[model samples]
Target: MRIVWFRQDLRCQDHPALSEAAQKGEVLPLYILNDTHPGKWVMGEASRLWLHHSLKALSDSFNGHLAFYKGDPLNILPQLIKETGAEGVYWNRCYEPWAITRDKKLKEHLKKEGLDVQSFNGSLLWEPWETTKGDGTPYKVFTPFYKTSCLKGEPPRTPLPKPTLTCAPLPPSSLTLNAIDLLPKKPWGKEVFSGWEPGEAGAEKRWEIFLKEGLKGYKVGRDLPAQAHVSRLSPHLHFGEISPHQLWADVSKIEEGHDTNHFLSELGWREFSHNLLYHFPSLPEKNLQEKFDRFQWKKDPKLLKAWQTGHTGYPFVDAGMRELYATGYMHNRMRMVVGSFLVKNLLLHWHEGEAWFWDCLFDADLANNSASWQWIGGCGADAAPYFRIFNPITQGEKFDPQGDYTRKYVPELAKLSDKYLFRPWEAPEEILEQAGIVLGKDYPLPIVDLKASREEALAAFERIKEK
Candidate 1:
């Protein structure tokens, strides 16, 4: 019997390791929750909640034969092997630094014991090592990386079909899904995850809906937070409920155009982030551009709390944070806006934003979270310029012109007109009263003057530039 280990790749369809194992002989599906090795990068509360439902769906697909264990894989895998007499182990690759180190050691140890141990690339379209520059160094910029290397290099392998499975009986020692304790004890857990369907079936259905309704006007409409142009597939992709290969192959069949090309490029960006993390293992902790190490960052607990609780006084920024808290998700445009406000306007460290997102976002990914925060901080490869601060007022007016997205999250400002929705402090007292709103009480006054904060952030950037 072969042991097919499930990690981020949760779905049975198009699973390389699972298909290969199933083709060989009876397969024992195993999931090990290794919290200790990941340290600070362990799966956050939102991710755990999603996993709880996802695991239940997967186990149901296997007819309750799936096995679950919680501990270091080094100890648990060997014990399972000895007990089940499994001759081989197979798993898909994970790109995290800790996971890479752990898997390498496990594979070598397993091989030494005369067992077949193999890992397949089931996540990324192009492996990080496969898409390097002619000099064999990783690409630091994304445009050339995608256009010159990735697009021009060997295409992603065709997705595998699910193999017919002959299952081994569940090991008696396998723990129940609830025993893993992935769900929170609080009432908010159910409320936050109410609309999300976290499973393989849900993922497939979402993709189908996106293909029909969302993909047509995706390029321009994707920028509008209120619009339903986006696929909302990040959490599914993060959990590997759907494969990039499947998405790419299916989309490639469509008539090539701006919408299709732009959508594909977004996937390319996901690849770019992973490439950065794989090449620079310290990506989550350090600045890629060394000069940013000397950048002065502020520490203000009150301001941080205001930002976190969606009381930041910048409606656009507050709206994004509120959406994230309410739904465990935020629009991509809003992610940049809120990120810029924290790292630039507030002069807080990017790590603060990264940590908050790690805890709050359902789709939070280590590589993307780290890289995107660094981009906002103007400290990573091909990062946004430090001087380019996103004006919350203009951003809101531009993207959410009708106030649909802002009002949905920051509903206290619902009665306010579009003219003052993004900047209520500038509204006349009569106008505020007409809307049944008081600036400081009903919504909030701008916490910091945008002009002053922009200048301060620019001056701070200059200090590091001079150094």
Candidate 2:
């Protein structure tokens, strides 16, 4: 018998692992929820909730033969192999540093046990090392990275199909969704649970909807936090509920010329993230260049609290934070804007913001979240320059002209005019009173002046270059 060990690849559709397992022998589909690396890096509460639904959905697809375990997979898989007499193991690839290490150890252990082990690329459309610069080094900046990756010949024209036979019809196994402690016991999960429906079917439905209606205007409308123009498939893609190939396939079919081409290149950005993670294993944690280590950062607890609680008094930043808290997602543009406000405006450590997102976002991907945080902090590959501080008020006006997104999330300031939405501190005292907002009580005033903060950040950044 062969074992199909499911990691992030939660779906059966386009899963090369299942096909390979079936080819080997009766597949014992498995998923191991190893918290052994406690603090090693686990999914947030929101992500755990999504995983529960996604796994339940995958099990539903199968006739309940899939097995799940809670502890170390290295320990559990060996026991399972001995019990089921499995001939081999097959699974998909993951580019996260921890995952790469885990897979390597598992493969080596399994190989020593005299069993066959195999893996395939499913999480990303292209491997990180594939589209390097001519010197064979990974692309550090995004524009050139995107260009090189996009210019490379397209992904395989045809995607792999679901395995014809997941396993030679096996007797029911003793695994259910509740057996894992992934679900929350209390009432707080209600909001997050309500926001998502996990599994391949839901992912496909989301992609289909995006491809049909959202892709055409994705370039123009993706920046607007108020609309659903951007594909809301991050969690699915992150969890491997849907393969990157499946997403790429749908976009590639769009006959709308430049729009279609642009969409495909955006998909390449996701690949670019994975590639960077693979090559720079310390990525997301370490700066791509080392001089950033000397950059001065504040450990201001009050500022950190304000930033985390959406009380920064920067309307757009607060709105994005609240939106992230309410829904387990945020628009890509706001991610940069809010990240800049925290790192650049507040002068807090990038890791602090990365940790907050780690706790909040349902789609808290290791590579994307870490890379994005570092990028915004002006400390990592293709990062926004340190001098380029986001004027939160102007960014809000430009990206959310109508301030609809902010109003929806920050209802206390909803009645405030669009002009005052971005900068409540600058509003007249009467206007603030009429809006029932005290600079510090009803809503906090800007914690720091933007102009002063920008200059402080830029001057401090100069030290790094001087060294």
Candidate 3:
């Protein structure tokens, strides 16, 4: 028998390790919740909730034979090997710095014991090492990285067909799903996960829906928060319910256009983020550009709390934060708007935003989250310049012109006119009363004066630049 360990890859389709193990002999599917290895980067509550549903679905696909265990995999795998009499262990790779360290140790130890141990690339379209510059250095800028290396290089592998499996019976010692305790004790999950379906089947359904409905106007419409131009596949992709290879293959079959090219480039960005993380493992905690170490980041807990709870008084910013808190997902445009607000307008540390998103977002990946936060903070490779702070009111006016996206999340402003929807503070007293709202009562006053805060942020950037 061969042991197929399930990590981020939860699907039966396009699963490399599971396919290989099934080809060899009877496969014992196993999942270990190694909470100790990740240290500060432990899986977040929202992600854990998703995993519960996902695991249940995957187990069902295996006819209820999937085994679950918690604690160190190094300890658990050996015991599983003894019990199942498995000759080999196989799993796909994880790219987090801590995961890399843990996997290296585990692989060496397993090999020392003379067991067949192998890993596969089931997640990424291109391995991090596969797409470096001619001199063997990793690309720092995204455009050159995508165009020069990825687009100019060999295409990603065509997706594999799901392999047939001769399954092993469940071991008696396997823990029940509830015993894993992946769901939060807080009573928030039912509503947050209402529209979400978290499994391979669900991933297929979502991909089909996006291809039919969202892919046509994607190039221009993605920037508009009110439009349904996005795939909404991040959480599924992160959990490996669907593989990038599958997406790449499916999209490649379409007649090429700006929409198809742009959509593919977004995937390229995901690859770029992973490349940055693998090459610069300090990405989650430290600034990629060292000069940012001298930068003065603020420490106002009150502002942080306000930002977290979506009471920031900037409708665009508040809407984004509240959307995240309520749904475990936020629109990408909103992510940038709110990220800019936190790190620039509020002048708080990017780490603060990164940590919060890590806990809250269903798709909160270490590479994407850390790299994005640093990009917004102007401290990452190919980062947005510090002076280009997003003006929340202007951003709302531009992207959510009809206020459809903002009003849905910030319902207090639902009755206000487009004229005053984004800038309620500018509304006359009578206009406010007509909307059945009062400033600082039904809704908050502006958290900070935008012009003043922009100047302050620019001055702060100048201080660091001078140093």
Candidate 4:
């Protein structure tokens, strides 16, 4: 008998570990929720909510055969093995630091007990160690790493077909999904997940929608937050509801074009992030470029709170934050805008922005989240130059020229004209009165002056420049 463990790789389609285990013999599919995370990166509130529904979807696919348990795998796995008298355990790999440590110990202990153990790369299109610089060293920049990632022969063996399996009966005393309580205690989940369907079917539906409609103009529209051009695939991908290989295969079959090339390049960014995290485990906390250590970051809780709650007075940044708080997802361009605001405009630490996203984003990921924040923080490999500050006003006018995105989330600014929508502070007092927006009364004033803050941020950057 074999017990197949489901970690991030949630779906049965294109699952190598699930395939291998089913071919072996009777398979018991398991998803375990440990009391604690592999590290302090606990599943965020949004993630917990998403996990609950995704697990339900996975369970339904198995016809109520998927098992849920909350405890240390050290305690849970052995019981599962004993319950089924399973001689082998299988799972896909998780590359986070804590998962690495735990998996290492578990594999050794299981092998010593005379049980066969196997793991596969069911998540990534390429393993972290698969691509490297000519010197066999890890890459610090994206362009070189992206090129090296593509040269590795044909794409990942056409994502394996969904293998059939015989569901084994639970031994006994199995916990129900609700018993694990992955959902938040309040009623907040209903709204947070209203726009999403969290499961394999949902993931596929989203992909189809993207391919049919969104993919055509993705390059131009992806940056525009108001449109539906972007595939809301990050949460699904993070949870492994869909395999990267499946995405790659479907995309590969499409005739090459700017849309195809640009989208695939984004996938390469995903690969780059996993590679970055594997080599630099401290990515979530430390600066990749050490000089950032000398940079002075602020600790103003009020500023942090204002930024977190979407009252920074920058329409683009506020809209992104409100979108995130509303849907647990934010547009990619907006993520950078908000990130730059926090780390640069507010002079807060990147980790502060990183930690906030960790708690709020439905797609809160270890590799992507950490690497992305560090990249914006200007302390990551191939990071943005510290001087390349993103002016929210220009960004809004360029990407959301009609002010549609700002109005969508920051509805208070809805009645303002496109000319003054992004810069409400610059709106003549008559316009504010006409729009029913009494600046300091209806919406808080700008938390900090952009001109002064930009200067201060530049001075801070200059202090660390010589280092």
Q: Report the lDDT tens digits of candidate 3 across residue range 209-273.
A: 99999999999999998899999999999999999999999999999999999999999999999
Q: How would you encode candidate 1's per-residue C-alpha lDDT over 1-467 as one tens digit per residue? A: 99999999999889999999987899999999888885698888888888889999999999999999999999999999999999999999999999999999999999999999999999999999998999999998999999987788888888888789989998988999988778866665678876688889989999999999999999999999999999999999999999999999989999999999999999999999999999999999999999989988999998899999899899999999999989989999999999999988899999999999998888889999999999988999899988899999999999999999999998888999999999988889999999898878888777788999999999988998897
Better of 2 and 4 by lDDT: 4
- Candidates arranged by lDDT, highest first: 3, 1, 4, 2
Candidate 2 least-lDDT 10 residues = 166-175
Model 2: how far residue 124 lies from native, Å: 1.5
lDDT tens per residue, model 2, 1-467: 78888888899888988877777657877888877763446777778878888888888788777787788877777887877778788998877777778889999999998998999877777666677888988887878887665565455436788886745344244355688889866555676656467899989888888887887777778888888788888989888888878777776666757667777777777777777778887876788768889989999999999888888889899998888877888888888888999889889999998888887787888888877888888888877888888888999999999989988888899878887889887799899888887778878888899989989898899988999
Clash count of each predicted structure:
0, 1, 0, 0
Which residue pairs collide, candidate 2?
Answer: 128-275
**Taking the tens digit of each residue's C-alpha lDDT, what string does model 4 give over 331-356?**
99999999988998999999888888
Clashes of 3: 0
Pairs of residues clashing in candidate 1: none
Task: Please list the C-alpha lDDT of all candidates, in the order they appear.
Answer: 0.92, 0.81, 0.92, 0.89
lDDT of 3 at 47: 93
TM-scores for every predicted model: 0.99, 0.95, 0.99, 0.98
